[model samples]
Target: MNDRTDAGGNPGPEQPGPEPTGPEHTGQPGQGAADGLARRAAAGFHRTEDGQVDVLRTVGGVRGLAESIVPGVVFLSAFTATQALNPSLVAALAVAAAFTVARLAQRTPLTQALAGLAGVVVCALVARSTGEAKDYYVPGFYTNAAYGTAMLLSIAVRWPFMGLVFGFIRGEGTHWRGDRRRQRAYAAATWAIVAVFAARLAVQLPLYFADQVQALGAARLVMGLPLYAMGLWLAWLISRPVAAAEGPRV
Candidate 1:
């Protein structure tokens, strides 16, 4: 009985010792390493997915909406300031510089610079042509009013184009917002800029028609105050952190 009990307690052919629980229990160290690597990879992928979602959510908010309005306001202000100071080649160069800066801030420096150069050329040609044409040319004040109107109208037409150009230049993935939302925001912002610009012209139109403000220079300075302030305010509003949060991914 003692011999049988001892044999039972001893290792038997049918029963092997309990398997090892240590790292060595695995087939090889490399296998353990591979498993660890896979877990890390999976974790990384999940983190990336979560981060992308957060970015999308932020862009969908009001901040993104405000950010979208900023570049336009900046451009308008730059144009006004440049025109006020130089009124000719210098002003055009200033506008070009402003557009380039705006694009650069959005991360599309080269493309914006090229586009701005093209715009400057076109504007210069138009200005020169009108200046030379007796029929097309009017008093500076009327000319200024007409020019302001034309600019505002152009803003209306080019709002989308500007958005597209800026997006491409900046490598912003694409229009994240739906067409309806984008259009609505753009229209509202563009109209606001135009309205302000037009108001300044309206204030001067009477004086212009009455020959009270002779030089476009005097009218420009007089009307510029309100317009400049309004433009700066608009820019400040657009540059708020909330605005940046609302931009669409692409």
Candidate 2:
């Protein structure tokens, strides 16, 4: 015979080579599928051109300073302006409560709350050292103590509001960008601040004129306006398309 068998122990001509046993043949399709899923997830969280954390840090650094310093001054000035009002404790508590509520509603960051509390302590110490409390509050000891407590609470509550406001503003700018959209949003935010300042002035003028309160409203306005303006400028700068010279590192 020719040493070729079909149904016995001889190899058949139609039998193919052994199936692929390595990743190249077996795992390639699975790897391709996994890679596709990773790409989609990365695309969802990180902007194609910029990292998400980097953007948040940059915006937060700039906006945090603006929000903290400006709002701090405004709140302090408001307290000073209302010093002569009856039930000073009530006024102070009300201001503190408003800030606290706003902050809680917005879920502000913890760092912001601590910073605000520090500011309040500083204000209280300043008021006590300056002898303003002695001058304004009759039976000066008790009144000063009451005022100090109120100031402390007001300061304590500010941190939350600062976090909320800054976060909202930064988030809005981060998630949307168009020259016109940014410009309009910037204008609107600025105008809203202006309106609040204006309303405060209107309410405060009578008290100022009657000599019942100091002219601290102007100081408050001055302190807050620059911050809002600077924030707008910063937003504009960040929103600009990265220059060709800088080349994608941004």
Quick one: best lDDT, which candidate?
Answer: 1
Residue 175's lDDT within candidate 1 is 36
Write down the TM-score of every candidate.
0.32, 0.30
For candidate 1, lDDT tens digit of each residue in 1-250?
0000100000111111112243333445354443343233222011113222122121112322222222223333444455332244344445556655665687742432443344344434544565521111123234344544653564556433222322222222123123555444444444444454566556655654554422423434334323433432353233212234677332
* Alpha-carbon shift of residue 45 in model 1 (angstroms): 37
Candidate 2: TM-score? 0.30
Candidate 1 is scored at a TM of 0.32
**lDDT at 144 for candidate 1?**
43
Residue runs of model 1 more than 4 Å from their true location after superposition: 1-177, 214-217, 222-229, 232-250
Question: How many residue pairs clash per model?
Answer: 9, 0
Report how far off residue 200 is in candidate 2 (Å): 19
Question: How many backbone collisions does model 2 have?
Answer: 0
